[model samples]
Target: MTMEIPIIEIKGVGPETAKDLEGLQIATVEDLFEHFPYRYENYEVRDLSTVKHDEKITVEGKVHSEPSLTFFNRKKSRLTVRVFIDRYLITAVIFNRSYLKKQLQIGETVTITGKWDQHRASIAVAEIKKGKEKRSRVIEPVYAVKGNVGVKQLRKIMSAAFAQYATQIVDALPEQLRTQYKLMDRVDALKAIHFPLDFRQVKQARRRLVYEELLLFQLRMQAFKMLQRREGKGSPIPVKKEDAASFISKLPFPLTQAQQRVMNEILSDLKKPYHMNRLLQGDVGSGKTVVAAIALFAVAKAGFQGALMVPTEILAEQHEVSLKALLEHEQVKVALLTSTVKGKRRRELTESLKNGEIDVLVGTHALIQDDVAFHNLGLVITDEQHRFGVVQRRTLSAKGNNPDVLHMTATPIPRTLAISAFGDMDVSTIDELPAGRKEIRTFWAKHDMLERVLTFVDAELQKGRQAYVICPLIEESDQLDVQNAIDVHGQLQHYFQKYNVGLMHGRLSPQEKEEVMVGFKENHTQILVSTTVVEVGVNVPNATVMVIYDAERFGLSQLHQLRGRVGRGSDQSYCVLIADAKSEVSQERMRIMTETGDGFKLSEHDLKLRGPGDFFGKKQSGLPEFKMADVVHDYRTLSVARDDAAALMHAEAFWKDDSYTALRHYLEQNGVFNKERLD
Candidate 1:
């Protein structure tokens, strides 16, 4: 059998260009074929009357005036071209195209295709071709590009690559799956992705590719789970009901039904011999911390050390304080390990952990550093698991051999994403808040409400309460000139002369930031003005008010998290969202926040509004980008894929089924296959 040459073998693609293509992970001809467009440019010709303002359109008309050129700099120039159609003179601006001035001859007809900006009051032509004998207009494909690479160049190279390697690309998916799913062949799908025959072809091709990607991902997760179960190496920690019950009895408040259900699930997982990897999900002030404390107690009863990793130093300190209070009478030894504990204290803590003197260690990423080692570690828990990458979580867990991993997140994710991201782990959700917890009163206000909001904050402060005034930016930029944290802090200091104002942002050093946070947490500061750095793990019960400036700039999920900072205490908390955006999508997002306090529901709505890109910021998660699948829109497909994966794995015949070799290979190639497969 002769193997086909990779896409790099294509002519005219030098080493530099090939490296650029490889940045997108397109190395082989097959890789290139699988690389799909992020979006399509529909250059279908339309009439001038059909061209809406601020929408991309393709129109053909006669040039009514000579093109004019304006120079911004030596390297920068803009050209304006005018065309007359339907008795309307439509002008198009070609930015950085001084050459277009010579090409656009007066009284000549040309077809232009590009985006229309009403602010510039012109249609900017991304591509200008002379109107000649043309068969049909091509709907250009727009791929995700990297440094110095533009859509035009990518399209040209991809077209050439496809023409040469299209024949060699084979369908990796089995024929049965393709036929059952009504999917197109690999070659046709690739061509349609880059140069679709029509809109219907684009849709169908997209469906086929998304299904394949999601199906493979699901299969990989299933395989990992199966492999783990087969190994059966989990340490069984016998749960004593009295141990958990006694701890809960000491609590000031009764456990909600939701918390009890989650506790039961955790207890069950601990009793099993298989290693437990579970996520404890809950809303703010839902008492997930107490559930975690119970789990830690159960692990401690089994004479195994447990570790809890948080994202920030302040959070680790906060957890230490809370946990110490909860487990005061327990025989388990608890120790705090953060970057802040330095010199002799840090050394002593590390020594205690290594010597098994500490039964439970709580800290941030410092706990997973090379210098830190745990003695007889058996269980690991992470708060705000989304903030830590998969590799970071794995590293922390690896401190103990196959430690039962428990992750907690207040950022409620939709079921589809949760399964997709953490499919191998069992999930326990604490959906109910504790009794006497009040819903945070939320409102959308404009700039005019600033004085009123400030007055309310002052009133709250008079009651010996604290408030959070969050700004979107840390500093003014040309792109974003919204109110910054430092500027806001200074202004607030002047506005409320009697109240102490503290400031914090990402720009501040870790120590400086921690100091400011401590001040706010201790109520030494009446008002804390900050940026999104407070988005995760900053808990202050007395902070009854959250005022977010330019709320429209934030995504719905983020807005929800920021709003969650309030409403943690018994006080009637309020969240004020200030934005001038009246756009439908923006308004809808803000409306969802005002209408519901359900983080999971808000996440689902946010998924619908912002799509999967904003759901978890997929780019930051190191997950492969989807070309066409809207994680929200194709959730049904994802569910189907998940079910199919489960069924296929459960079947007794799967182990011996040769037909699944391609899929197995696909999973292995993507680095998602279980390590047991190598054996």
Candidate 2:
């Protein structure tokens, strides 16, 4: 097929220009075809007298005089022209468009769309095209330009690609669906999207392309689930209600209705024959861990091994302690393994795991190591799933034979993100807090209020409650003048001479971090100064105060997670943010944090504040990137596509049918056929 042909085939595109195309990710004909425009320019002529200053409007006119060009500011050039619109000769100023001077003659008609400069009685040219047709105004595609690749160059390349490879653009959506959806042809849509004849064509092209992209993605997700089902049914773990009742009875407090509901959903998945893929999401300290504990207990009660993988060693240790305490009476053997386990200890732990001596094994990425094996693994649970990518999650899942997977995240993801990122998995949320849990008293103070904050921390410490002092940076940086953990640790230690303040940061060894966290858990350390490394599942119920320096520098989600470090116990908790926020966004974030303790709401605010690209902050969440579909705004289309894909897959023998052959081939070509990375 010509789809994989290189980009050097264009008429004037030499080696250098072809290399520049790589900056736009256009190396192959397929890449060039998929390099969709970010926006379009509508050159429909409008009345000049109606629009106000600075409003973008299109005008039809003829050149009144020969255009003039002038050079300025390094290599910049400008072209000035007088266009006669109806009876009025209006001046048009175009920047860096020297080529326009040659084509514009004294009487040639032109269409100009730009911002109106009322005082100057002219239009600042945003786009100028040679056209006079009133009914068929050109809707020009605007590709994102970078490096040396300009709009003209990209347009030429796209035109050449369509001329040569239009026949190769196979319609992944079958004829049946195309007719049913009243969509445009695949080739027609591709051409009209780049060079549309009218507004109706652009609308049709966009709808066809958007639906195709979204449908293909949804098909991949559902196909993956179908393939997993065909592989084999998982070992069904029967729920023992009596044992669960006894376990709950031994707990110090009652489970919230939310937790009970999630537990019931998980238990339903466990007893099913097929492998269950579920996502458990909730606000931090909302009793997610206890609910996961109950599910882990059910897995062990079925006499099959379960592995619970977390992102950090401290979280692993914390889970280990909590699980052992909760499962002790039930005779469920729980074990911990991490990078710190080595030599004789490592060998013995792996051996015990292989022999099925451990009912639940908790650890960090170490659980996915090749040496770690299971005798009869049935259930796999991963905590803080965003910190681990699909590779790690699937690697751990591969250790078991068709194990039921439960992905837990304390950092609540917004519905837009959750639906798109985890659309394939069944989602269960623990929205309500447990009984006796108090709302964390949140306060935002300027840097000058540190003395009062310190006094409050001193009072909390005097009551034998520990505190956490969070700094944004681990080391002093010349770029940012924010507080570092080392400096804050020293200052706190000096201020509270009687209290033992331990230091922790990312640079410390895993064993050292474990030691510091253990000391804090044991009440030996009254305060721990650290970076965002403790932003995940570190449960120290004794810690009642979290003081974050330069809190405005952090995202609202991060601040919420840091606040979650406190308020784990029954006693009232507090979070102090010391920042003199100058930006409106930062000040708004502070206000939001002080106003509510809902992580999901804070995450939605964070999404709006930072947008989709910065929301995850370099973490992999297994979200598929779409060419034309915007998950934030096109969620309705996403839902429809999901339903269509599901309904199509649910049909009998759909994969083997000829009408669905193109879709199956697309799934294979798009890298969705890989089973290991499907999760």
Candidate 3:
């Protein structure tokens, strides 16, 4: 197959052009095929009078006069061509292309395709071709090019490459599978993707590509699941129904029905013969911690140690206090280990953990360190699962022998995405908030309403309720013109001099964060000014008001999380979003936040609005960056791909048949398929 053929081997790609293509990670023939269009331009013929400003169109016209050239600055030139089309006059502007003077002759019947600029009353020429169209309309692909590579130049190179080596492009999916899915042939898909006849063709091509991308990804995850099973045998820890009920009964508050259901699912997994890789998803104030504490208690009662890893030191500290208090009567010992626990204290914790003196250990990433060994590690629970990378989670689990792993994520992922991303794991959701939890009333307001908002917050403070003033940044940034927590803290302090104001951000030390949180939790601080650090694990029930400054800069999921901090208590809470965002997208995000408090629904909205890349940020959500597959937009296709992957994983043809060579080879080349551990 020509899949591995280097771009340099292609006919028009010289060393210079190859190096330029390399910038966009297109070094091989397969990469060229996978470089899908960022957008498409339809060259539908349009008359000058019918064309609107900012609309991209192709207009065929005769040059009315001799083309003129104007020099703008040194090394900069502009060419102006006036054209007569359908008894209407239109101006075409070309920049820095003095070499085009010869081809753009007077009275020449040329076709121009470009965006009409209303202000300049001219069209910025994207492309100009002499004569009329002899073929059907072409949907030109616009690629994410780099190194000054023109669209025409890249298209020409791709055309030549396809004409020469397309036949060698083997289909990664088997013929029967492709037929079952009714997908376009791999070669035809590549061709249509690069140079489609119409928008329908583009969709067809994308459907095939998206399916292939997602299928390969799912296959990879499935392979990982198989590898995990081969690693070691799991210890089936027994869970008594009475024990679980006792643990829940001992909690300060009764568990929600949803929490009880999720707890049952988790306990059932712990008792399975195979190791559990389950995801526990819940919204804010859903009592996920109480459920986790119950699981930890069950594990401890079964004569095994359990470890809980969180993202932040402060969160770990908070969990330790709560869990120890909840399980102290049960004789379950809980220990806290973080970076701050150093020297003699760290060694003592490690020794205690290794000697089974500590029934449960809670810490940050430090729990994965080599010295933190567990005598009988039965279960591993990671809070804020997205914050920790897959390797970090694996490292902690590796400390135990096939430990039942329960990943807890407050970030609600759409079910389709969760299936596509974490297909290997089972999922349990605490869909309902705890009983007595108040519904947070959300409001979107502009900066002009700040005075009234502050007054309202002051009133709330007088009523003995606390508030949170959240900012996007910690300190003033020269580049970003957004509200900073430090400045906002000072402003709020001055506004409400009688009420105490506390400051918190990611930059604060663990001890400092703990101190600030302690003040806010105890009501010593009437208003807590903070960054997104307070988004997770800080439960202050009396905080009835949440004022987020510059809320437009945040995503829907984040806004939902901030709103979650309030309404934890029985008091009716309010979340005020203050921003001057004028963009349609920003306005939509704010509107969604004000419309619903459901995290799962907000997450689905966020995924659809913001692509998965921006939604997950720089971290890997156990999902590969597909070249074309969109988790939200192509949700149906993703499901089909997942189903296909499951069937393939179970089929003997996928493993032993020679016809499946390409699929196996592709997976092997990408290191997606793992060799079974030789136990």
Candidate 4:
């Protein structure tokens, strides 16, 4: 395993530099190769005629004036000169480079790249081409450099690594598949990705490398799924549909088609002798909770306890209240556990849970504590499951003897991500809303129009409907220019003095948060001004109006989640997004929020905007940190590679076949999967 050779073996990377590289998670030769550039900068000359103001461009021109150097602030100096390129004349200034004046003589041709200042007809020169080199600058790979390590230094180290150890990089894709897919050899792609000769080579190499990464990932996932299926060690909980039916009969309304479909899918999995690994994806207000409730009730009736873990204490309490109301009559005892549940109550609750007296336990990460135990645990359900990492989920599930695990997310995930990130699990989508639920009318307004927006909220409040005014910050900050909950609450209270306006933020104690939530839920507060803490699972049907101040500060998915707080009941709901959106990206986010209420569409846009790592905290989704593959932009490649991987995984001799020898060896030696991950 030469790939295991220490990075310090590379020339120019001494012990100090090696320690710095290790800060970036690069300790071995293989690690250095895998540390691909995040982006590439092309210094090729551009057409000056089409260049915009403040845009980076490179152009060659004659030196129309002698360069004059001026010293400033003792150490800083500016070298200014005028150059004419084609038909346009512009001034170029290079800061702190007084020595460049000798090279920038009049009547001499010069080339420079910098941001174009159209109004001033000048360029803030980033780099000045020296000597008579006529061709455009080389396209350079840009690595993510932290402390001590510079980009140029990293690039040098990478080139050295490639020079010495690239031959050790084996081609995992068989020749037949590579030929069919028109992919480059693994060694060539890795070399090109690190030191691409041109933009075209970068693209081609990226295509090949992205495919390899995604294929390996999918193979790992499919293999895990196959192994789990073969094991079949899960508790064979009886599918007590009759008990679920009786509970549903007592409910105020029947399950929607999507809910029934997903519920049946989950229950059917429970009936199997093998453990169920499934993802339940639904829109913000698509009734996913009801489906979860039904599953839990069935599990409880089967003489086994269920555990529901959420991200926040407020959400845990809310789930406990709702689940209790839904299952208490059926003699199913539901309890809440969080950091707030302490001392005597905590001990009593845990003891009841161990004794099998509590049929269902709902809580935050507290459910994963070593002290927490479940008697005959049959099912584990996590609400808004994306907020918890894989380790947390596994630890909670480990408390039981191979219990069925159901992960749910209110944020609708795109199909591409579902196939890659959660590829190991079966997927169940709830795309339909309840029959009587109304579409939430969304609006975008400038911050200056707050008076008019308040008037609308006032009208809604007058009609006996409550409202929510959300801000980006809990308190004022010296850095960010955004609305804060405390100030907004004060302003709203002053304006709507006739009604109570409640305020909530993270700094508040758990009891205070509970009191505020209870006040708002009971309609004791007409308007609730809060921060993003209310995004997860605060359900208030009577509140029909949602006004988000500084809405542009939020992502599309987040805005959609906040809007889901309303629109729960039959009454028409309205969401007003008030912001001083300056950037086009922010404006576009606001426009999309007003355009449609589809969480899937918004989530797709969100994925494209924020990427999968940020969209679902990377560790929580267990998505690998891919260097070349982008789940959003490269979805087509992802799909093709996914299918190819599935076929190869299902092949008769994938593990032992000679054709797949290189592939299996590459993956195993590369350490793609671990015991904890597979389990």
Candidate 5:
């Protein structure tokens, strides 16, 4: 393939237009080919008489009358055109698109796609083509354009580019793979994706491209895994079986079998010669911290220090309390170091940490500061691992000589995605909640049912139970109609006049947040109105009811986490999801939440409903975004890709086989073979 040809060479692209295309990353001919449509317009010919009201439809017709523009309001205008289709007249309305008035000429043939309005008997034009070309029913590609580049101009440019270079685009996948996966060739797939004659072609093209993308990603992950296995040795901290049992005996509660299994896995990893880079995945309220504390205790008993970095100050403080209580019998000194600790007290804690006087250090991002030195740091664990990136994790581990690093997350991801995203690390899941943990009964209600929900909350409070009123936004957003914590706090205070209401948001000072959380924890505040700030590790067993306002705005995993806050206690708990969601996707998300309390299932559902963006947050998941591949929808293909990559790698000789040369080169070009990433 002539991949290096510049996009500027394409017809209709001037210097200014090239700059606009560059904004969307269409630099070369290959990039233009890869610039898949964000969406498509269905331009299939349809009968106007059969069009449903408010349903988007496309039909070909001849302009029966000259277009006329009329002002509906001071700032709004509409362009109306009458068209004749099969001897029937239908009106097309172009609102705020008055510039099209001159283009809609009398007796001109055109094809238009828009919503059909049965009341006015008009078509609300969304898109229109000038000429009714002799083309079959097709889905027209809609490029993500900017500046002066309209969709029509971009389409013409893309058509010219494809004509000039389509045949030159060679298939990256080998013929054997293409046959094994039943994939269309690269050139055909690209052409069909950009300009498909039917939905069948779109499906074929998407399947082929999604498979290629997953195959490349799996290969890259496999390479990283191979590199990690060959990296430097780690500081080992082997523990005796009797010692581990003794450490567990000091716990306030017995560890669940799942927790015990994961702890054993961590212990075994520590005993290995190579460094331990493991992910500890557990659902909210699953007692992951207990297992983490056990691992830290083992490292401390082996005469080495451990550090646990969390995302929030309150969470860090909570962990400090829990760990101190759990390990005090062993005389392991636990220290808390956060940005809030200042003056001489901070210096004293730093000195203690440097001199090994502190056996375990738990804090927020403050643990990664340059001045924060450690004494024989053997294990480093980051709680709420998704909040921290790979570099941040590496910096903390760099504090020691290749310390055994354990990443802990309360948000559970599906097994396949976990394998895809964190293939570099070994994974252990604490699937079972601890014994005696009560499952929270979830309820879904619209805003109209708010009165009933508030009554239920009052009843729960009267029974000596606390409640949480979670709002989706910190402040009222001008764009979104979601409820805010501040406003909700004010309203709830007035509504529940007898109960104390507290407000919390991300904008609050650290001290302020701590004060509010402390108030809620001590039960002085009966109802805490807050944003998702308290979603992670704000454990209050006495809090038995969680009322989430505008719950439709939150992801399934977030909803699950919010529900976890209440179900921690043995007393019966309930999660009230107040959402007047109008979209089918939001309704489905709410329904799924009410049906099950499983975090893993919720996460899978969330991925399908919302894409991987909610889970990965764009680039932080440590994998580049695929142009066409969807992690949730194409998970089966992803597994197949992983299997194929493994098979190919195993068969290749010393990573230099002729069949693997193109794959290896692609990986290297994309920095998948970077030594630092491997390390």
Candidate 6:
């Protein structure tokens, strides 16, 4: 016999309410049990005298006066209420709640709870009840609400679900492991997460749950990696040490020790029978592209065609130019394919690719289109790997016979995140920058600094050098008060009319964008005022100044990428960040740019400050969205989990034991085991 839980046994959840729950991805008792609270509300009771005007608190006071109502707008039917707590008066305003006037009688005592607004200098009551018998706790669980699902209602449903599922909750981790990690039982942790008696209990329970989630995820990743190593089919493409040395010797500058180390690792992986599914991560201007080009050349020399896929047409074009120049001395044919390539030219390129006439092909998503086919494609390279989804990468990989994949990214991801997000692939890092590159001078300035910045740009332009002016938005929107690129372009044109000004944005056509980019590159336009469309490409060697407007609106990595546009040339460059907002996080993010040029250090700081989900847009990557596990605070746990997963997978006991059965089930349910189904 099974004990019936109220939420599970009760059959009267209406379709409308069910749809609201579905929006949160909660449809059953199990889903409700796992729907953790985003934050906790600690309502500490305080006396009226001790109550701060703006601080949130719960107080019990006698109502000394009758509630008074005032009408603000008859058109919108807005009303405000004034109530006195003892002798001190405080206002409780509600929108479109004029009907509440009937409930508050003269000199009636009531208990109210909500956030205290400093602007109004009153407590904004979110919930109110009559009589003095109401009991308020010190700690309150604030859950994400659905339609008709208030905190109290959500608590009741969760309580019922926990009662039923507590016994059914299987421990994913072994008893010894849990004890060693100082973690609570899975069932107890879930219960405490939903209904914690105190803040300490909540914190402890959250830590355990976060550890478990990460541990299971790490286990699955380790298992998948092992399976891939065992079963993956790959052919070794051999290259002599002298051949690699000759290629590196021909480069304009000497390779950094870090770059040489990464190349050697890739060379070893290529020599192995198993295909290489490796991620090459480095800071902007860390010489990732050069390393990738070397690997492509090696593969090409091995008599296998290689393809480089980028996210945008401009990046595709840029890669083609860079790779062609790098491999020009070598006997290899490289071709570019983009959406812009039309009719006869497209047909010719496709025919050449299919016939193995082209040694290397570089293009955007056009490479994966149904009409596009490859001949003897043995290696694949994707720049800015995070921009492409898992399905998109798989689609490109499927173009060839499961070719060896080498994904590259300029955005330096934190170690914890790298393991969680790209756990299925081996990682290589280029930790050092190339020689002779000067660190770009970065500064954060207020609006008052604009004139000085413009004067500086004018001085640079006078010397025949170019500059880039980046705006956050393309067009004006009534919703946001941000400065648009078009408005900035007009202002710049008026201010710097003597110099040519060019504009580019996502709204502009490909032809118009190409024209402006070409002008900027050729110095026809000394100042290119544009949006982030130029963030990925549009490299101008003569440009030495980059002024980013509203720098606070950009992520740390993105801001780093924008700054990378200028410092590419040999001459000294300056990046001026103009921000009006004075948020602490924003200030810290900007400070990272000024303080250090290391992309990995900045990324670690970003993860610590912004958390994982916010660092990577929730919908952008298929990596699991963490609710509580912070990569910064949980780094130790992440390391332990990674080690534990690896050790367990290597143990012969894992295959025979039923202890990991629940973990395996969880992985399968999350689709981590099935690589083919990721798309």
lDDT of 4 at 295: 94
TM-score order, best first, reads: 3, 2, 4, 6, 5, 1
The residue ranges of model 4 lying beyond 4 angstroms of the native Cα positions read 11-26, 38-163, 224-232, 236-257, 293-376, 386-400, 419-421, 617-623, 666-679
Score each candidate by Cα lDDT: 0.81, 0.85, 0.85, 0.85, 0.85, 0.80
Q: Give candidate 5's whole-model lDDT.
A: 0.85
Candidate with better TM-score, 1 vs 6: 6
The 10-residue segment of model 1 with minimum total lDDT is: 670-679
lDDT of 3 by residue, 1-679 (tens): 3378999999989999999999999999988888888998888787667777799988888888777888878789998988887787778899898877777778889888889876666789988889985446457789888786878888888998998898898887788878887889889999988988888888888888888888887887776666566664688998787898877776778788898899899999888877999999999878888999999999999998899999877688789989988988899999999888999988888898889999999999999988888999999999988888889999998898889999999988888778877788878999988766668999988999999999899899889999999999999999999999999989888889998999999998877888899888888888999999888867787889999999988889888888888887778999999989899999999888888889999999888888776676646655667689778888887787777777777787788888777777766776654443212
lDDT of 4 at 370: 87
Error of 1 at 533 (Å): 2.8
Best by TM-score: 3
Q: Which ten residues in a row have the lowest lDDT in candidate 2?
A: 670-679
lDDT of 6 by residue, 1-679 (tens): 1122323353445666666667777766666777888887765555567666666666545554455566667734433456666666777655556666788775777766777775665777766666663444567688888676678867776676665567776677777788887889877888788777787888889888888877877887887877676666666777565777889899988999999999999988887876789999988789998998898888888888899999877778888999999986798789999999989999999999999989899998888888889888888999988778878888988887667899998888888788888888888999999887899999888878899989999999888889999999998889887779999999999999899989999988877888889888888889999998887775688999999999989888778888888988888999999987689988888888889888788888877777777777666646676666766688888888888888877877665567766665666666655633111
User: Clashing pairs in model 1?
Assistant: 7-29
Cα-based TM-score, every candidate: 0.76, 0.83, 0.86, 0.81, 0.79, 0.80
List, residue by residue over 1-679, the lDDT tens digit for candidate 5. 3388888898778899899889888899988888888888776788877777898888888999989899888779988899987777889988897778887888888988889888887888888788874566367888888887889888888899988887788676877888877889889999999888888999999999999888888887777666665674775677665778898986778999998899889999888877888999999888888898888888888888999999888889889999998887788899999998999999999999999999999999899999999989999999988888768888899899888889998888887678778866778998888877778999999999999999999999999999999998888788988888989988999999998999988999878988999999999999999998888867798999999999988889889988888877779999999999899999999999999988998888887777776665565655557788877777899888887877765664526656556676777777865724332
lDDT of 5 at 193: 92
* Candidate 4 Cα RMSD (Å): 4.9
Residue 1 lDDT in candidate 2: 18
lDDT of 2 by residue, 1-679 (tens): 1277888976677899999999888898888888888877766677888779888888999999988899897569999999999877789999998888888888888888899888888999988888675544357788998999998779888998787778878777878889998999888998988888887888889998888888888887888777677675877778787767777888899988898889889888888888889999999878888988888887788788888998878788888988998886788999999988999999999999899888899999999999999988898999988788888999999998889999998888887777678777878988887766799999999998899999999999999899999999998999999999998888888999998999999899878888898899888999999998888757888899999999999999999999999998879999999999999999999999999998988998998898666678745545677788877777777888888988887876466688777776677776666523222
Alpha carbon lDDT of residue 300, candidate 6?
A: 82
- Candidate 5's displacement at residue 143, Å, is 3.9
Per-residue error (Å), model 1, residue 13: 9.2
Tens digit of per-residue lDDT, candidate 4, span 1-679 = 2278898999898989999999999999988888888887767777788888888887888889878888988879998898888888888988998878876677776678888999999999987875443643367888888989999889778878778877777677888888998988888888788877788888889888888888887877777776776574887899787877787788898788888889889989999888999999999778888888999999988898999999877778778888988888888899999987899999999999999999999999999998999988999998877778879999998899889999998888888889888888999999887776789999999988999999999999999999988999988999998889988888888899999999988899867988898899999998999988888757788999999998887888889989999998879999999988899889889988989889999999988887888776655666777767788888988888878877877777776668787777655655554432223
